[model samples]
Target chain A: MAFINYSAREINCKLVYYGPGLCGKTTNLKCIYERTANDAKGKMISLATETERTLFFDFLPLALGEIRGFKTRFHLYTVPGQVFYDASRKLILKGVDGVVFVADSQEERFEANIESIENLRDNLTEQGFDIAQLPWVIQYNKRDLPNAMPLEELREALNPTGKIPEFEAEASNGKGVFETLKALAKLVLAELKKGGK
Target chain B: MSLTPQLVLLEEDQRQILDVAERLVRDANAKAVYLVDKNGQLVAEAGELKGIDTTSLASLVAGNIAASGGLAKLIGEEEFPTHFHQGERDNVHITLVAQRIILAVIFDDRSSLGLVRLRVKKAGNKLSELFDAIFKRAESELGDNVESPFAEISEEDIDNLFSD
Candidate 1:
């Protein structure tokens, strides 16, 4: 859900980055945190294991300038992608305004990617959100890997609809990170403008 | 089970909420009080917030509540309405208001847990009433098909935000 404070002249939205384990979900957030100007970003919090695998989520708050007089603030989050953390993932999606599904482009992780997207759809459905209606995009990460699957193959499997915007990204190098974010943000704002859920 | 997409807080609504929060801070003799939505958005805060990262606090508090709520369900309960964390120098008393917002009081040597809990209960009730009224107003406004403030937003406006 979006929080619009007329008194403060600010609008806050929640965006979630979801994917399978080791799919670069956390890396995407870290890249954005590093690239964002200090004044435009807040502290990025990661609840992860000692080995740095995400335990619960990683949160980053960004000030995406203003729309009209309202300051547009986005709270970005990434759920722990390990299968056992399904509970945490559902909790993080409670009030999501938009989502970015980061699919690992590695050929070996193909099945894992499908399983994760199915998990995403089921989770959203349990929360009463239809996957087709939500403002979301897909990011095919690890594009620089030697064993990465072809873009068309990934799309044919994951985004069969071909209606959702898709990006090819290598999050560690920050490629296509902001592009994915900006596209999702634009969709979210457009939804708000239409006064739709 | 679909949740509302937007929680619109108008100026008058904020004043009423802050008034309740400020009074709770004084009556509880606490260092600070914070009201956060279930989505982890900070609705309002009162008292000496210096040195406190309110944004982080709000998000963590919401996470705590959600996790705790999950635990409650595992035990066949609905939800835990209150949570207390006792520290050597300070303590936090968290309460759920109308199951929609969190009312948290951070207190130290100046106050006791018993007093903070008592005051929070009263303040929580008042806040619940205020929120119910606000929701009603918002729903009625929606029924009237009031124009969204962002209805006039242009693609250029969105492009400009990312231009920098």
Candidate 2:
């Protein structure tokens, strides 16, 4: 859900990064936190286990400048991608305004990618949100890997509808990170514009 | 097309919420009080906020509530309406108001949990009424012919935000 505070003249939206375990969901958030300017971003909080895997979620509050005089702030979150953390994932999606599914591109991880998407669908339904109607995008991450599957193959398998926006990213180096964010933010803003229409 | 209700806080309603929060802070003898949306957005806050990071606190509080609520369902309860965390120097009392927002009170050794809880019950009732009115206004406004502030936004405007 988006929060529009006319008193503060700010628009706040929540966006979640989701995928299978070790699919670079947290990497995507870390890259954004490192690259954003200090004044444009708030402290990034990560609740991770001792080994650095996300235990609950990673949160980054980013100010993406102003639109129509209201400061647009995006709260970026990443679900624990590990399958057993399904409950945690549902909690994070409670008031989500948008979703970015970070699919691992390695050929060996194709099955995991499919399972994660199915899981995403089921979880969204459980939360009373229809995945197709939400402003969501897909990111083919780890594109630099030697075992990375072809983009076309991944798309055919994952994005059968060929409607949602997709980006190829190597999140560790920040490639396509901002592009994917910009696209999702745009879609969210467009949805907000269509209020009650 | 968004199925979820968007939380829109107008100027007038914001002031009312802050007034209640300020009163709660004084009555409970607490260090600070905060009204946060279930989505982790800080709605209004009062008292000593100088050293506090309200943004991070709001997000963490919402996460805590969410996790706790999930636990409640696991044990066959509808929800856990109240949560308290005590520390050596400071303590917190969290209550779910109207099932849509969180009212949190942070206190120190100066105040007791009993006092905070008593005051929070009254404050929560007032807040619930205010929020109920706010939601009604939002629904009516949506039904009216008022145009959205974002109606004038263009693709170029969105692109300009990322131009830097």
Candidate 3:
């Protein structure tokens, strides 16, 4: 659901980044916050623990250039990827307009990637959104690592649907990061034009 | 139910809100300033403390307004007018304006609670009048398509916002 300010002529949408632990979800946001001109982004808040683990979530509000005259502001957030924080993840998914699944491309973390995707699917279904119909995309992050998984296999395991856009990204270096963001954004606008039934 | 249209504030009134924000910060020597609607759409903000991330915070505040309002409905009560959260690390004061808008300020630990409250009280009334006028304009120009407020701030202009 969206909160419309007919008075302001602006529409605010919430977009959350989801994935398993250490999957570069937060990193993707850090990169964007660093790259976006200060005025284009609002405060980037990372609620992390003493050891730097994301305790709750990473939040950033990005002002994508406007659409149809009105400013399109995306309130981007990232769920704590640890499995035990499943409840927290569910809470953040509330009223989300889109999801960016940041999968760890390393071979050793393959199972974590699978479980995270399953968790996302279950959570979205529980939230009353049909996974197939929602605006979504997948990013194979950490692609520059020496132990990264083969893109072909990663795709087969994570994105069998072949419908949502997929990008190979090294979030640390800002590779394909914007591509993934831009793709999901396009989908969001398309969904809105159809009235987001 | 009262269905009468409220008077609207013009662009100049909005400018007054900005002016108040600057005065509240400079004359008051406060930390950060924020003026949001009753719905929590951030209308304006100014000050230091980078990374405050108003985008998510505004929407979350709006969500808070919604959740609280929903709870009020469930209990068959009128809407809650205003709320405040004074945290150990930071202080937030939210004030109601024109009975339809909210003005909130996020400040540091050093600022005195007495100072923030006093400034907010004075600014709130001015904001209320401005917001009242804006609503009137909104009613009159309901169908006009407006460009994004962000569009007016160019890339260079945006970079300057955080250039220190």
Candidate 4:
């Protein structure tokens, strides 16, 4: 849920980056954290198991400048994408304002991508949020890989609606990372203007 | 089963709870006090917070509470209301408030856990009342269709954020 502190003149929104295991969900956030200026970003916390996979979630607090004299802060979180971590995934979507589905562009991971998308929809539904109505976007990541699927094919399968914005990203090199984030942030703010019902 | 209510912390509400927090710190001699929403947003804080990263702390605290709540359900318990972590020099006491917020107190050798917990219990009740009143007001005012300050924002304004 969005938290607006009138006293502090700040607007806080939550954005989640969700995808299958090893699909660059964490990498996307790391890219943003590395590129953001020091003053604009807070400490990025990753609660993971000893082996370093995200155990619960990764949290990065960002100050996205301000609008109309009120500071805008976006808390970016990424759920552990491994299949067995479904329980943790559901918990992370508690009050998400927006979501970026980071689909692995590799051809072999196609089914895993579809399954994760289905998982996302189900989790959001369980939390009382309709996937179609929520502010959502898709990022076909790992675009630089040799076995990456065609953009059109991926879109036809994942974003059949064609209504939601999509981006092609090679997150390790920071390609299309900011564009995806900027587009999602814009939609989230627009929802806030509509009272975010 | 329902839409999450929008959270609005008004100036008056902030002041009221901040006073309670400040008093809790003074009375308990704690290192810091943080009021965090259950969803991991930092609502307010008081006392010495120099080197601590309250942002990450808030997020981790929420995660802890959520995981603990899950464990409670697995065991057929409703919820676990309080959690305490005793470090060598510092200790943390986290108590759920108003079912939507968490009060986390950090203290050290300067104070005893008994004293901190006592002060926290008294102040937590006061804060819960203040927050309940504020949440009710925010809901009512929202139902009245109050104009949001963001309604007038232009696309250019949002775009400007990424310009740098």
Best by DockQ: 2
What DockQ results do all the predictions give, each relative to the true complex? 0.63, 0.66, 0.08, 0.60
Residues B1-164, model 4: lDDT tens digits: 12667788777778988999999999999999999998899999999978788889999999999889888988999889999999998899999988889999999999998998899899989988988877786667555554577878888887888787
Positional deviation of A180 in candidate 2, in angstroms? Answer: 0.8
Alpha-carbon error at A161 in model 2, in Å? Answer: 2.0
Q: What are the per-model numbers of colliding residue pairs?
A: 1, 1, 7, 0
Query: Mind giving the per-residue lDDT tens digits that candidate 4 earns over A75-110?
Result: 999999999999889888988999999999999999
Residue-by-residue lDDT tens digits, candidate 3, B1-164: 01222223334555677898888876445777876543335767777757765765665665555456556666888677567787878777766677655566777766777788888788777777766666675555422554324334344433332243
The digit string of per-residue lDDT tens for model 1 on B1-164 reads 24553578888889999999999999999999999988999999999868788889999999999899988998999999999999999899999986789999999989998899889989989999998776676666544544567888988888899897
Q: Model 2 off-target regions past 4 Å? A: B1-3, B140-147
**lDDT values of the candidates?**
0.91, 0.90, 0.72, 0.90
Candidate 1, residues A79-108: lDDT per residue as tens digits? Answer: 999999998999999999999999999999
Off by over 4 Å in 4: B141-147
Best by lDDT: 1
Which structure is stronger by DockQ: 3 or 4?
4
Task: Evaluate residue A10 in candidate 2 and report its C-alpha lDDT on the 0 to 100 scale.
Answer: 93
Question: Candidate 2 on B1-164: residue-level lDDT in tens?
Answer: 33456788878889999999999999999999988998888899999857777889999999999999999999999999999999999999999997889999999988999999999999999999999887766667644554566878888888888899
Better of 2 and 4 by TM-score: 2
Candidate 4, position B28, lDDT:
93
